[model samples]
Target chain A: MTTSTRVSARRLTKRFGDFTAVDGIDFEVRAGEVFGFLGPNGAGKSSTMRMVGATSDRSGGELSVLGLDPSHHGTQIRSRLGVVPQEDNLDLELSVSDNLYVYGRYFGLPRRQLRGRIAELLEFAQLSERAADKVDNLSGGMKRRLTIARGLINEPELVLLDEPTTGLDPQARHLLWDRLYSLKQDGVTLVLTTHYMDEAEQLCDRLVVMDKGRIIAAGSPRELVDRYVTKEVVELRFPAGQARRAAPRTDGLARRVEVIADRLLLYTDDGDATAEHVASSTLQPVSTLVRRASLEDVFLSLTGRQLDD
Target chain B: MLPTPFRPLSYFWVSFRRTWMSTLSASFFTPLLYLASLGVGLGSLVGHGQRLASLGGEDYLSFVAPALFAGTAMQVAIGQATYEVWGACNPWSGAYRSMQASPISTGQIMAGHMAWIAARALLACALYLAVSAAFGAVKSPEAVAGLAVGPLTGLAFAAPLAAYSVRARHDQPFSLVFRLLMLPLFLFSGTFFPVSQLPVGLRYLAYALPLWHAVELSRSLYAGTFEPLAGSGHVVYLAAVAGAGLLVARRSYEARLSR
Candidate 1:
């Protein structure tokens, strides 16, 4: 990924009358990088994506896409940007190939060129065999792939995906991740939002963690983990009734200790040392396991709440 | 360069190509059948005489052709204007939403939709005129002028409905348009019979509606009895309605989509 910026926003915000959806936030995305917005639902990730896509005007802020102001040059900016909204909006009246062909025409692409491109894209999406099939007949994963393929029809320079894999099975999510990896290898800038921590860790070169319309943290996923949490964590689960009472006994053994429902999480620099400390203590009577820190750990420490909750 | 607002017409044409068969059957054949059953089957009883004298002393079929032309245009235009616009805005297909992400702006999408509606009205009117001619409904060569009037009537309905449909979150209101608005216009406008036979109040009301003006304009053109000042009045009315519809629809589309 090049260091040159493709999208820049300063104090960008969006408000729906009485409610603020995207609070004032600042960030920049570089060309050819897999940038991500990591957030839970209602975190304003989709609202921000809409602004960068040039489909939704920013309520207040200075925002530039492809170096052009969205209010003045929205049409021009959108011409080169492909967007996959959180939901699949494929035309149900058209076939698989027609969906791509119809969307390509919106870019003012010539019919002759679109025919060839549709063929190539169908193959790229692994949907060549379903080109003539009606879009209604396609499975959920197939529809998602077609939506992504439709986004690529114009050969856009930057692609925005909002919650690209929200409701997909693990297998389908991985397949989409593979296609996205291939796109990144081709030097196309990628921006996406996801609630899945693993998706952010696996695909994002740089990302921002958003919560409640605000950017709580911004950095590479690894960097955020390193900054907000320790290197390792030990999971010590006790019987339900005894877990809350067992929390204070492991306090001085680690940098921090978190008591969730029935388990105590010990955060430290060394998992083996923490696990040993937990074993010798009278804190745990059920099970103990140690693992490396993750984005989930970082988020839990930052918000005092679980990522998926 | 083609105006930026009309650029989405290309997208409309591509999608229209796939559904032309069903679209043609609805917009063209349905009107053709109406002309046959109502104008011919019913007109046979009201054959050329004083019984038909109130119909401008012409055969029932010939007198009704222009009104049907206007009515058909309205039908075809409003058909695309409603559910199709709703479909584009709906989260399901989001055709307009998808286009909004491209180089096309909201005005362009509205222009393209209206253009497609006009295209359908053109085809439907031309085919209906031809069917009427086959049944000896054409009184003069000037009947072709109704081809132009067809889209104007269609736009008179389409432009307003298109604007309203963009803001519609559900389709229940669209069906109400047909039942409440369209049905009344078809029956009260000078489509089935001359407005001269109506009560004085309803006659003025008929004159106030756009379709009545369309029916009069198309009929005068087909009969070669064009009155310069009167004809200009009809033309001006339809144009004003269409122009106003375009202006309002443009603003509506711009406001709805930009958000």
Candidate 2:
């Protein structure tokens, strides 16, 4: 086995007794790519990440990280692969930097080399000031950055993050995104799982939207939106049920119009033109806005929900 | 074989350093209390006139010190193997969650934990013996010759228990086994009053526990009753427990850490 390929899986399946967590799924992630698994809770995203991280056994199928089979080369694979699980698993008793140093020593890294790496990683994660502080004292965001710094102690070729920004504040999420984007530029392959549409769209170059342990769709963010939603969407609102009464304005203006709750979605190649057509028609609109379709629209079209819970 | 060329010695040192403070407290405090309270307080109640079956009569403290050493060893070793091991491996504890993602193998973790416990057991047993010596509890100086055997018995018992700890999702299984299986073994393994004082039906458990042979061989050494030819059986039993415990702990570690 070689330290390459980043990630590879074939028919990878995981089951806990009778329940199937990650069904037979196959994929490959090359070096220097940001790949994501999008799915809801218990949809097997974390379970799949566990198997790939070499901490959980797969009931069936072939899997490898860094061109090495996890079952046989677990220590090697783990040494080269950084993993951040759904929870912040930092060592609470130790200083934030000691957590990184102690973990680095486990990989047989000497103190001389480890000290410099620790400094670099701490700075990279923006945790330089918290180096001497105990892990328990840090806020949720600082602890997560510490976990990320620990994962990179070995200078791993690939990093796996399961819901990296699940509970962080908006500012924290943006900071994590900035750090991850730099990692991408540094050529570190990242495999993350998140049900958040915006996080996936922002981080992943390509992603597979998973449901019930299966990938329903796979493509880049723009590609998925284009395939599943129109170029432009119009949101129409009424004070009452007048939107339903003015249905004539929607006819022949677009390919499809779906009504959910109190808003009507107008799907068309040109949203401004559709707005002009509606203004000229018998329909007197209350408000009008046109914007490019997004991953959220794709998810809404596929799953029929504004956002996953 | 380890794929990452894992340094077992390094793992051992780090684990030892991390746990040294706690080990010292348990080793010093637990043994000191039992020896002082039981050997001094309780031994006064049992006196030298007390007869303890085939091993023959002796001072109560001298008679019970070796058995106490063995019993205390089991308690500490098994304690380290179970709760501490469980805490490290459980995802909720986040110890293994952090370590397993590094170069350390599950086996190394299991070994590092048990090895530290074993060393601590030996240290505690030694500390207990030194206190017993100062108290004039020893009938023969040859008893010091067998201080090496005390931790071996613990290692034998702790290994399997450590193995079990790696799989326990909670504390219930160990509680049942300790209360039902281990407690009886401790009481009737010729350690306390006598195995013969127990009901005939319960005598079989004393024979089954590793502690029975441990207590017997220990009393022989402390009382200067060594039999060059006949003592092999007791030695073998302790060896078997040590060997079996180590094997199971190692394998269970592999099961837990290796995907």
Candidate 3:
């Protein structure tokens, strides 16, 4: 592995009895980069994340985190890495600050150093005012923030977040993204798993799109969008049961036409031209919207299914 | 810095601060009330009877106190291990999962869990012994050995029960364990009476349990009748049970947490 590589995996596989959760996949996470695994649920994203975190054993393959083998040096690798699981898993019985304090202790962090660190983390998570409140009493957003803060208590070089914003509202997700962005600014490598395409576009400096236990595509979000999809997309909503029948009429107007439930997506270089073609054509739509291509479209185009589906 | 194996204790210590009042009160009052109602109230009727001979020629109150001490340790340990261990693995309160994500290994987590149970057992048993002393149920200074015996017996149950709890997906199994295994062991393990009073089959079964060995050891020590070989045998037996349980718990924690 290179010096800049924080995590490296080669032909890593994880199997549960008869089921293969993570097929052989190779990826590298560099330092100070926000790397992401973007996939729908059960895409083996979590299994891959757990292996990198050194909490799950790989059935077969070579894996290294922080330049050490996880199979033999899990504790050592984990000591220098932070993990925020998909579920908050905050100790509901303890206060917000106590959660951070106790988690730091698990890393054998000195109590004296942890006190200052806890205060700083609580502030960083915007939970300084609620330090003494029970975790059960905190809102969903506050709990997510505290979970992230707890993950940072050990001052790890790399932090692994599994579906960090899976259940948060828009405002909460934005706040969390800002915190994560600031972590990146401080040069902390972040590896996260999210089914949210926008979240990947917003946070990931580089990412891999996974499906069925394999990394199907890996690149910068803009690269993936530019390589796999058009520059713009036109979304047309037709009358009930009309989207599929209307799909063929707009065939030549766009480079690609996809008929999804109740809507027809026209992928083209100019969404306005596609919309104009559709407006003058025999097909009549209830509504039409033109927008820039995004990771969502890239995922749809690659997998023939929505990212959140 | 604390050693790696004991790191997870900090979590229990922090959480204990919030519920220590109720926990300590229950620990203190449960034995006190049991001693008052059963030992004192019933001892008045049974103390002067020929049945005292079967109880080693001791007052009924003194006879039952040490057994209660050991029994209470088992109760407290199982009580702490069952729900907490289950909750630690459960989705809503994934405390063990949270710890597993850190540098701590599942082995360390298991060790820390048993250590916390031992600590709580020591505290609870100490209070029980003090109450026994106050009630004049403590017959000799050797009775202080109950402290060691208490936590040992507690661990014998806690470690294995924790292993079982780690695999339990729901709370229903816990209540079933309480109703079937724990309750039966608590009642028939010589806590309330001597194994000699039981039938031949039941008596041998009581002798096979960890709590009975603890009760017999505690009773002999409290009555100033401890035999070196017998006491050593009981100690070794309880330790073996606890050691085996810890082994199983470590494996279970590793298997479950690593997933």
Candidate 4:
């Protein structure tokens, strides 16, 4: 991950009349870095991406992409930036290659240049064989690859992907990740939003966890885990929110207790020892297991363990 | 050189291409059936007034021909401003969202859709007018001008509806459109009978409708009867209505797409 800045966002805000979707968020992405926005549903990740992508307007604060103001030079900015919307918005009526072609045309790419680049991007995304196939005829993975290809048509300096793999299966998501990785290796800067912690860890160079229009945490995958959670965690299920009620059970067994939706995670150096302690406690959890702490834990710790309304 | 000025034209082409075939197939048959069956079959059953007003100035088909042409223009406008609007603006799979991400501005998108409305309305008006002419409804050459202005009328009527379409938060907007624009225009636009012949209370409502102006302009062109002689106001009213619609549509596009 090259650490030269490519995307600079300062105090960006999006207000729809009275409701604020993104409340003054600031972040910077360097060229060749796979920066990510991690948050759950309604977390303002998409709104932030829209603002940074140069499509939607920022209600307040300064925002810039590729050294241009989004408000004044949106068209020029869009000509250089690529955007993959949250949904797989491939033109169903058009073929896979045509989707990329039409998108390229929109950016005012020369036909000759776009044609050759489409051939290369098709091969890069591993969909050259499906070039003639209609978008609806392709698999979920194929559609995503096509979207990525469409984004790359402008040979963009920064590509904004809003929840790129939100609905993809494991295989599809991995294939997409591989394509993204290939793009990164080529020195293309990518900004993506995803709820999946694994996705962020796998693709993002550094990331931020946003919740309800605010960035609660920001760091690299390892940096965040190291900063917020222990190396390992022992999970104890005590039926529904009961694991949460038995919060004091982790006092002697491990260090800090994180009560998530389904289980209580006990942060400890010795996961097996923590599990053994859970078995001995008067508070009988329904189940007990040991595993490594992930970004999911970091997210909970940073964004807060409380449920949002 | 700035490539081409087809950004608006291409946008219209894309929208028009989606349903143009179906619209063409339907419109082609609508006028033929209405003119052939009604002009011959229904004309024999109706009285002197029907025969005179419709086809022959003596045929009911001829008399109602101009009205149907205007109504069809309104229908086309309504269709574009409603179902197509929903398809284009609905959050589920809005094309505008995708287009907004590109270099295409919100104003360009609105221009594209409105242009498609006018283009499709004109095509339908041409076919309907041709059938009316073939059936001996139009006595003068002026009726061809009806086809020319029919789409303009549609553009005027559909623009406000398109504005509303952009602002529509739900399917309920279609209902409001029907009650506010479509029904009121259809019932009072001098589509069936002359607005002057209607009750004074309802006549003013007809005068306010974009479709009424379209129907009057179309009928005048068809029968060479450009009377009531307020020629400048008729043209001004149509242009003003179109201008208002454009202003609202541009605002709506900015509201929906820029958000």
Best by DockQ: 3
Tell me the interface RMSD of every candidate, in Å.
2.3, 4.2, 1.1, 3.1
DockQ list for all candidates: 0.57, 0.37, 0.81, 0.34
The reply for model 3, stretches above 4 Å from the true place, is B49-51
Better of 3 and 4 by lDDT: 3
Query: Docking quality tier of candidate 1?
Result: medium
Q: After superposition, which runs of candidate 1 have C-alpha atoms over 4 Å from their true positions?
A: A1-3, A237-246, A261-263, A285-287, B1-6, B47-51
Question: How do these models rank on lDDT, best leading?
Answer: 3, 1, 2, 4
Model 4 CA deviation exceeding 4 Å by range: A1-4, A93-98, A110-139, A237-249, A270-288, A306-309, B1-5, B8-19, B38-40, B43-62, B172-184, B225-229
Per-residue lDDT tens digits for candidate 1, residues B1-259, read: 3445666776677677887898777766776788888887888877632235678877787788778878888888888899988888886677887778788887778888888888888998888888777777778788887789888888888998888998888899999999998899988898887899899998999999888988888888777777889988988888888889899999999888887
Could you tell me which 10 consecutive residues in candidate 4 chain B have the lowest summed lDDT? B1-10
Residue A196's lDDT within candidate 1 is 93
Per-model clash counts, in order, read: 1, 3, 0, 13
Candidate 1 iRMSD in angstroms: 2.3
Clashes in model 2: which pairs?
A: B156-B241, B156-B242, B160-B245
What DockQ number belongs to candidate 4? 0.34
lDDT of 1 by residue, A13-121 (tens): 9999989999999999999999999888888999999999988899998898888899899889998898998988888777899889778877878778989999999
True contacts kept of each: 0.71, 0.53, 0.86, 0.36
Query: Residue by residue across B43-83, what tens digits does model 3's lDDT show?
Result: 88885523377788888898889889888889889988899
lDDT of each candidate versus the true structure = 0.86, 0.78, 0.90, 0.78
